[model samples]
Target: MDVDPAASAKVVGNMPPNISVCILSHNYAHFLRQAVESCLAQEPGDYRLEEIVVLDDGSTDRTLEVCAEFGSRIRVIPLPHRGFAATLTESVRHCRGDWVAFLDADDWFAPAKLRTASGYLRTGAMLVQHWEHVVDGDGSPLLPDPHPGGNTSTIIVDRAAALKLLPVTNEKFFHVLDDLGLGARMTHPLTFYRVHGDNMTDRATPGAHQEYMADVCGEIAVRLADLRITPPPWASRSALRRLTWHYRAEARAHEVEAALQRGRRRSAWGPLLRELASTVLAGRNYRDRGPSIHSVLTGRPCVRLAPSPQEEP
Candidate 1:
């Protein structure tokens, strides 16, 4: 297809000042169209959105065609599968606006989101986030009202500030850790969060918590060092508790494996038993724990290890 030159020019010329919209996607064709249209539907003339950069993280679906339909209004950047962190960094690096906002392919924006957030653009505030309307798989409202949670829809950050704190999104350690510290370091009062079943933040299991713990511990370590706070006694105590849990978790895992070996019927107990086993097996020294299952379930990675599950063997 011959590219439209005039459309291309319009895309380049009407750059919104101070804010760029960046979308990261992978195989989200079904929802990608709505996401793009929602951003385009923002109150016209209310905000000069500089650019719309969609980082296609090696999507095999028709996501590219859907984005192309927007003409030159959105720039599609293709990337190898570097996971979430790296792809985000690419979008950030390519962003021309002073402020950067994010949208996932499977998610979208509220009509007034950008207009509402325009009040807080400055050099000092690293981020400006706000409440989001929760929805179901079909995009119907699930929550009665907006809630304070961290989804791309709820994120608007100072581009330079983010770069200074952490340069590369490809580094899993950097993205996960910085997100927690960054949230703690700043006050956010902008954007709307839309919760849906397909939303990335909704998926979590107790068994997956080891990954979550690792991310939090990593971020807390960075924050503590940044603030020059000595490690508290609870940190060490927690470490021991995790280690003890690891062995018991391993033992329980062995029991579950034995059960499976004996070919028991697969049911609620079967899944529960396996989940517990995975949680234990996943347990690493406190230092290695990354983002928590709660963070995975919730949009933001809040570090609170609820009482470790009872030891089973």
Candidate 2:
């Protein structure tokens, strides 16, 4: 990420006063400067950004050069790639502000991203995230999931409480849809989550990808089962339904992997079924006991039950 020094300095010097923005990147110098500029462009009113932390996970590109140009306005932490989970965990643990925000290396924020996020945070809820724009490699808008606006962007939580819930860090060995666990615990409309082709999940290698996803689902099952949070009647039923679907999903996943290994792309049923199963489980968020099938595939925001699980799924 070889950003022009003058532009980089301007962005860093303009950071607001109360919030802290954390950007995680790896060899994405081309996209790093834009992301930082976006953060710097945030409207700084009464709610401002106090700190900005950029974690460079072993970028072999000019990404570090661009970061260095920012001087002290941003804290640059460089380390080998520990994967997203560990890197994110370290970043959050080191955050000093009451409100923290996340930005991926390949993604950039909208100018109003933080301004809007901080406004919502004032509500005193555990979180407040909003929709995001899904873009193509060229940055064109693509189909947005969950809410039409995008993934939740401005989430304000009691940092301590949110952490206790085992919030999703970038390095946790999540397979696919790993963030669902943390999102499940919190209500909709939290941070603006960007979906791009080069995202971590999209980068998963062939043979290893399927297994990683299976691991994520299995871990969620075990974690939710033992969590202290109680599921409402609907949520309980939803969990059971998801549990059933997960079992079948895993089975189909194995078959898909086996078929792929044999160089036989074969039929679509296996992969299609796996996706259907994941879709079903995701729907559980809306129902009191089980998620409606309609909402699952459609990505509609379901009304959360009054007293259900508080911890991430």
Clashes of each: 20, 46
- The TM-scores of all predictions, comma-separated, are 0.59, 0.58
State the lDDT of candidate 1 residue by residue for 86-178, as single tens digits. Answer: 777777788898878888777777677677666434212356555565555566655566555455556677676566434343222223222
Q: How many backbone clashes does candidate 2 have?
A: 46
Which residue segments of model 2 deviate by more than 4 Å? 1-18, 143-158, 167-197, 203-214, 221-313
Local distance difference test, candidate 1? 0.54
Evaluated at residue 91, the lDDT of candidate 1 is: 74
Candidate 1 lDDT at 73 equals 88
lDDT of 2 by residue, 184-275 (tens): 12223223344444556632343444455456545545544444265422235455456545544444454455345334454424564565
Question: Best candidate per lDDT, number?
Answer: 1
